[model samples]
Target: MTNEASLGRVLEELGTTLLDVVCGDAKRSGDVGGVVIYDPLDEPELPANALVLGVGLHDPADLARVVTQLGAYGAAALVVRAPVAPDEELAAAARESGVAVLAFARGASWTHLAGMLRSLTADSGPDDAHTLGRIRSGDLFAVANSIAALLDAPVTIEDRNSRLVAFSSRQEATDPSRVQTILGRQVPEQYTRILEERGVFQAIYRSERPVFVAPLPVSDDAAQPPLPRTAIAVRAGDEILGTIWVIVPEPMSEERSQALYEAAQLVAMHMVWQRADADMERQLRAELVSTALQSGPGSLEAVRRLGLRDEPAVVLALTVVESAAEHALPAQLAAERKRLADAFAMHLTAAHPRAAAALIGDVAYGILPLLQEERAVLVATEFLARVGSRLRPLVGVGQLARDSSALARSRSGAERALRVLRSGSVSRQVALLDDVHVDALLIELADLVPRGDIPSGAVARIVAYDRENQTSLIETLRAWLDHFGDVAEASAAMYVHPNTFRYRLRRAAEVGRVDLKDADARLAAMLQLRLMKITDPGF
Candidate 1:
């Protein structure tokens, strides 16, 4: 029911519940491109017609400056925290810039607001526009708004576990607890606890009719009394799908109650349709991403379908390093992979609407629509940081691909960088192709060498001498080379006296008939050691 063609549609959908127009015209003619958060310290490049959230800019003078700046960049609107009393300067800026100034509602979270805005503007095609009973399938916000219109009261659809799925507008008409629920997208534990104590949930689950709950007592002077709730369990045949909860001042009449009972049926159908459609979309997206990365005949078509046809982008490959101690079961590992892939997709989408991520085999690949390789590196690092150290994820970022056809090359670069990380040659969890180019090359070269080739030249002679005489010459040479000929550090690393290490180094040079001072000879020896898998484990 809502389109992103104008700022008016956003206002109409959200209403005065979560946002209020503080200044300028709400019916501005422009397509809302994307949602961006404003940071005074780091002024990010604003997308055209962007809805910028001025999270902490409250000072009138500062807000006025930002408003003009965003206007110059053609931002559709700027949202600051609520209670914005427009000064003369602020009002004049909004009028001259034609950038609508909106206020975020008190007690609502910026994350929730951003999420709602992004969902409204996400790119979609005809397949995603399919409808069930006039409401777009899988569009829960629209469904919630429709249900609210039917009941003439605010309502929320939640899962069996009491987690909020979708909620209607007019949330401000409810109590503080309801606002908190909307903000967190979940019922507070204290409220859920009270419901459990009173057997409210059990009653709703057990009955076929709507269960009416009386208002809860105020815990303290500051806490508002919770509004009464009328809840009905949504079901499909014998399986209970979820529940629809309406905030009412009192128990509803028979006709209104019947309306809610019937609404549950539609809600069940929509929920079922949403789940099926989501699964299909995920599978389709995975196929498209795979095709695009293959750089074959269908790659261009796949890229077009993915909305990344002419975009310069970067490819990122992510995987979990196996832990021997965990010895994770196959099923558990598969589930973990799916979970991480979904989270990765959500993270990338939130950062950039055009970004696409999907799990291809065991690795999750993400294509970020950005021309700057360094920014992609930063994005990957932030993702890893959010994932934390538990999964021990390694992300390999590739150079910028000029367009759809170049995606395969970027994917190759990413795979090579990932190979370096997986080979344990570097200790970092995230790296770009350029950062690990040498290590990646060495790994590739090792693959070309035959398994039985072993070490050659001076290194081979030293290895033979060490084997026959049980000497420390080979260790001494490796240590000296690894430490860049720093005798004290090399000796310390080998846990031997500096003079002893020096003696062994001289002996190794003599036995191998190699000149230690020759740079070319040292490079040859190092290459041989690398190819022999002596400097690192097998690639």
Candidate 2:
């Protein structure tokens, strides 16, 4: 395991940019366990020595109360919005509880702060998690800060797609556009459009040297003119990995330009290292998730390593329906599956920081740390809707598992629910096991019966008659049963006249020697028809 980061290290990295100490000695607070957001109405369980974000808690009394509570939980620090005026009671509470108090900068975002802290605190193997030259390898925040220090200007690192990766301190000193980028974590679309129209991005990507851009004119009445920017693309061989951009007043001198070019090389190295580390960690997590789901001899240890030992969670099994890519090449399907799995992992993390997801085989499994099955259903539905119908995504949410030991059972339930969906018994994309219990039971029954032989009884006779005479008797009977013996609905479903449907239904009953009026007889026919439909769609 990698060495845990101390609260002092967190302050050392972020203090110059985002945080201000209010009370307690951070250096003495030791290592922080993880970052957690404080929820007032429903407090989530905190890991030991957590760094808690006290969002929306402004009152001194409330702050003091939270500080005391966090201390009881052995939290390292409680960060509230600045500028905090620590009263005597609050100071006393902090002192008594031995919990350090910190203030989040006024303009900085809680989301960004949480993300930065998580990056610093997330677990990793020792080999890839260590520092290089006083800064953690692959730590974009530290790289951006170092670049800003060298350039004496605000900095923002962006991926090739123009998505913000990390930013330096003193963003408030930059233009309104920069502030907007920091707040949204993305360059505004209008700004990107203007750059694209001006061939600014093309120029930056095409050149290895620093490219200087003039200030953008005000695009709207309320918009401020953006400051001039100097950008250099970070490339690995022929591949452009990302760009490093600095807010500058003018084109740089030759020496500083050389420094910026050198910095791009460093940034490229970090980006590539981060990508490799991410792949390794993803594989490691996949193995742990697989082991935990098996509930085998190593399951307990795996669950502990995953930090989900005692947590109540729901298992969500997500897979692409065959109809979405039935004719696609195997490589294309594999790529799509991996893409969906990555997106699912990100979505789950955004939903709950403690949640874990991984792609196992063709299906992506997410362990959503939620208390309610209904909430899991809602989350799954929202995810499928957001992912759209391109893959025709399907998610099966299992019942809530109250602890780690129950996860295997929950996974089994989710798999059963997924099977029901894949068998085309249900029309909806997202389902809970409880919602489709009957269909799942029917699938289980089909599995129990032998696969080769035709189903027996009234449905078997109907199938044989259809095969022998090319009759519509099986279709007619299935439609009637599906419509619960409604002649009008059944006929409409089969696209035949009600009189014709009635005639076919009577002939089916006669050929099978069945009594339609008998409830037991009708029930038997319905069961057999369902089993056959599930086992053999052509029947």
Candidate 3:
């Protein structure tokens, strides 16, 4: 095995626990091959996987700046001793830069700490060698067992989200926290909240060392005493994958802590491997969804591959407004869009198991089985409700497709409805294609209408007369047609006297040279004017 130590082991040996983890808790699994004492005047010559800096860094701002620079140099972690506690700004910068921030106790010996770290880096134990070899052989269980045996403690491995991935087999020695985490496959939200208030997670994220958390007071009437725990971050480079937590009654010995740190490195390797496999699966699913959206010969085959071939389906589209996109950075916006898409897909899958959702560009598209048309509306409404006021996204639902062939048509209809929703005429969060059929139909036929085909002269003459005289002839005619040519109702709608409406109608007829007495002519005029509003850019 390689003779290397982690920052966590070094800190434990130096008798200093983590103060606050600004960022890079996941990266604490990295090996520490050397140590560097930082001098501000001189340029840093950091070695690979080197732990840098030491106590006597008094100013938080200056310390934060140095931490940032060390992060850029790819340092494993920053060791500092402050006269006063570091401020939040320093912690925030360290987090953003993915550098682990470790603060020693007040009046701690920097020289002794540095010398101890150097000596530790020069030694490697037989058990450590065995664990590292097992990790490389893809035996994560062996690594976990080794750490549990060495520390004589029950251990649990959890992903960054606190979801349990692996655990030691020492069930009898496990505490309530380990049992709860294993049973739920995640840390309980109540426990998570308590830890957050205590800054445990903050320390975990920023520290490249093991963080010891004391038991918290129980709120329940039959409250049980909390167990003490030692947790180390599992990381690959600057990317944190998970954490290895040991439930112990007291602090671990230096030898045991060092072994635990080595085990974390192995766990990080395992996590990286698992993530790579997951990424591959995600990419394949994205490709399948992309293929299903097309109308080519093999599109139905693609749908079959995703196991949604025979189900009645509809397409749903969600789009973020330009204003929201403008306010966020490109990277932040992209990440948000991805998060929304994943959330939508998860909800869709939960409701409709055969459904598929994907984010293509700024829009999120879903092809879900039409179990019930109302359910589609419910799903869309629920998604909007969950999003609430944060995104203010517009949603459009297409008509149901009875078969795969019509899937493309459903997608087209959804796009059409989305266009109408984007026009700002609808006040609701979701618009269905059926609800906007008239506008959709007019938009579809607008391109097919030939120039000067029918009633163009009458429409042009009426429009010119209204524009030149500042009158409302077109509005009156539209209202009359809408009310089925009811003169009294049209007059009421226009807020005009009956005789004034009649006079305007007559003038409209005279100016356009149209015979309003003919039902065919009246119907034609109404269709033309309505189509004009939809198709004409100036209108």
Candidate 4:
């Protein structure tokens, strides 16, 4: 087995000095060049078995170092061979080393040596996902199927150590369990004494051929399904990621095999893109969530940024709307916020329940930023129209909160408007927070005012005043009642003179046709005053 001349020449061709030539026989050690081997190829498997001693380096000094390391971790022996060399120093040192030294004068030929080294070197490739290209798992799945489709074969892509990941089907794609089982590794076949020894299923891995004969007896489905005669090892750059098993019912044409190879390549690239896209999408969603938490689109600041100062703005709740996941809640809020911002100048904010704006917790917080008074009312009506009788909505408008810091308070105002809407019996009624804020005192009194409680004549007179006088007499009358009808007190409270206040009272009496001094008239006057205090902003 020892042919130092031929072996040395082969090493010469490769021009590598990192060769460790160990020998079982001292006679074989004297003559060798750099990194020669003279030991028998058969040895105990001892890589991970020892703490170190990797690479199987061919240089004597490096080999010596490896031996020293393995010994420290309890290696049983050191094997060395002779390179065709005049390096007497290394050979002498090898003899003196204490470990069970196996020196070989004759071993496997250098022609064999040259070929074996190439195979051993395959796993040491520099391809790492962080340093080089790496396929994401999802991308690998997609590409695996694509490659199989192109090969005219059912291809199953498996990850390292032969775990099935994805595939194209030649047989039924259902029965996922069965499909996965048949994907990467084939079931072992039974053999008999009469049969010749079977070839290993993976033997073709040693060759450059695209397909390998599976070791077991596997038949094609329908007598014409694709073949599993060849498999291509998938690679991320130089590092092998996994293997793609191609099903060819029988041998495939060379052209078809080449096509399959190209398809495998495409699948690899596809997997890479899929990974990138999925990662990006996940990141985008994370950003959206952060945006929602910091402040949804309907925040006062958000509304201001919407840049609509003139449009009427009112906050309204969304009701009876369907939703998907809770994770999407913030996004929905942000979306509605933006929609309102665009349409209503971001005048809305998400409101809490028993507050205003329904589902602001589940769906949206609107900032109807720039809506006009009429437009805000219309928005309420439109919301009701969509919700139908299934739900009711309340709208409230306030002077826009100047900043996001004020949004929480503004939201309370919007809710109060909703309270006004719900507390009163009306469908799609809209109220303004400013009216609510300014009229809070009157609202308390109005709540005590009986419905349809205003005397008919009183109601008529009030209506007449609105039709005639440009000012809202409701607030004025409420103010008077609130001041206890003392002309002096009422006038001073209203920032008017006693005489002017008396004149307004006389006019009010004329409209009602009720005496200002009479007990029944006063009682009626108080009732009308209470109702008027809870004034409608439009008047």
Candidate with maximal TM-score: 1
| Candidate 3: stretches off by over 4 Å | 1-202, 216-227, 241-247, 319-330, 370-375, 382-389, 393-395, 442-539
lDDT string for model 2 (447-480, tens) is 8988765468777777888899989898888898
lDDT minimum window of 10 residues, candidate 1: 530-539
TM-score of every candidate: 0.79, 0.78, 0.53, 0.25
Question: How high a TM-score does candidate 4 get?
Answer: 0.25
The clash numbers for all candidates, in the given order, read 0, 0, 7, 65
Which order, best to worst by TM-score?
1, 2, 3, 4
Stretches off by above 4 angstroms in model 4 are 1-149, 161-165, 173-209, 213-229, 296-539
The count of residue-pair clashes in candidate 4 stands at 65
Better of 1 and 3 by lDDT: 1
lDDT of 1 by residue, 1-539 (tens): 23434688778667777789999777888678888777675555666888988877899899999999988988889999989999999989999998989998887767668777876665544655777768776667678888899889998998877777778888878998787777776788998899899898889989888889898766678567778989999998888888999998888899999989888888898889877876787899999999998888999888888766567989999887765356666776777777778767766765665688889888899998887888888878877776633456788998899988889999999999998888877889888999999988998888787776768778889999998998879879988998999999999999999999999999999999999899999998878876666344742
Model 4 agreement with the true structure over 304-422: per-residue lDDT tens digits: 33322323333443322222223335565455543332222111211100111223332234544332544555545544443323222345544454434444554556656655555
Give the better candidate number (2 or 3) by TM-score.
2
